[model samples]
Target: MSLSQSFIIGQYVHRNSIIHRLDPRAKLVIAFLFMLSVMLLNSWLSYVLSAVFVVCVVTISQIPPSYIVRGLKPVWLIVIVTSVFHIFLTQGGQLWLEAGVFSIYEEGVIKAGNIAIRIILLLVMASLLTLTTKLGDLAQAIEDLLKPAKRLGVPTQEFALMISWTIRFIPILLNETDNVMKAQRARGVRFNSGNIVRRLQSFIPIVVPILLLAFQKAESASLAVEARGYSPGMNRTQLRTLAFKKLDYQVLIISIFCFALLLALRK
Candidate 1:
């Protein structure tokens, strides 16, 4: 698939909307808390409420729902695998099916359903953050959040910078892979018209070029860093400052209150 056809996971789309305007730190905190609350939930009603919250946020973000759905397609396999494991391995409730030595229980099915929903919710929430916030903003917010760790000699800034670059390069690597595959195809390399071994071999031609390109990019990045005289633990100035506004606090309060109410209802 071409890069355009590939999923956009960590790329930001500029839009003037409540979600897009919120502070990145607030978005990060809210999404993390929401996912954690979803994990603690034990009822379908709670999951429904979580889903509604996610849909509402997406609507506020002004990002196309189609984009979100397309982005989720890449992760559907993971969600399905997680669901299948839960469905077959978990045991409890009424027996729904029995064939030979295998049996399906009602509780297992319920667990599977819950797991699937949770995975989708987490993906949607995470995608919302990256779709709305810029990578630089996210990195700064993370560094600020982890600033206290600096006192403990934890290299929080480096950690945050590494994470930001990793996220920023996800789309780049996918695009590079697509380009490499196309180039290989132009050279009469058939990636799909072969047996298992042949197909595996086809990837070798594609993988080598991408790896070389990746190393070149990494080396260039390192040189750029040194050219800028970047020093670990040195005081640096930010081009943009992050500050929490009244709207940020209001949204935080409302989200926390709603999530707490849902958790209470689950009891």
Candidate 2:
């Protein structure tokens, strides 16, 4: 299944590989550091290095490259649009194309290339995070990390629960949408055989069912939580605690090294 279409609801492939076993906190921090480095990078050489790093991380995770690429396919259009805009609208150096009020420059092309690479790296990093970490683990890690915020009068536990539920429900919602589409197709609803407006109108039936299903699920979940003694202003213990392992320390060290290297290069 295409990563974009797959219900994000399944158990992530459990692996004892380096990427999978690292602490979620470490992974989150490294992701942020990697993104920061990518943003700081301006040269093609740096971008190439970043791409290699991403490839190494992806390989270690042992997930299919097709899944990663497929997830990125949905956003390809946006990337293209942004690239085109930057290539034509960004002003620098000598113009390559000049017509009336429109122009494209060599510098713009370079800028566009850099921007596109940065975006792709960002997507890869995000996909890596999702692929390697289970939704529950991510939630628990977030809650633990945000525990200090509780002293500042924030509902960290409740907020964390909401995030956990949202991530867990994404795949379920996608699956529900797929089922709705299949049923509509079986009922002779031709999704692709109409004008833009007609196609949109056809989606009404599909959307309504999905929304109703989501509402029902939400209601059930709420009741279930209440029955389980879930209270807003009470302290709760976690079943699966997250701990920083040796690999997490190694990852943090590597991130620090990369950040320092990037800063040195920038200098």
Candidate that would win on lDDT: 1
Candidate 2 per-residue lDDT over residues 1-267, each given as its tens digit: 433264222336677788998998888788888998988888777777788888888898887787777667767877899999999889999879999998999999988998898888998887688778888788777788888998999998889789879877777777778888889989999887779899889888887899999999899999999998888989888787778777789889987797767656652
In model 1, the Cα lDDT at residue 140 comes to 95
RMSD of each: 2.2, 2.8
Clash totals, every prediction: 0, 2
Deviating ranges (above 4 Å) for candidate 2: 1-11, 99-102, 193-205
Candidate 1 lDDT tens digits, 29-126 = 99889989998998878888888899999899999999888888888878888888888888899988988877889989998998899888888888
List where candidate 1 sits over 4 angstroms from the true fold: 1-5, 187-205
Report the CA-based lDDT of candidate 1 relative to the real structure: 0.87
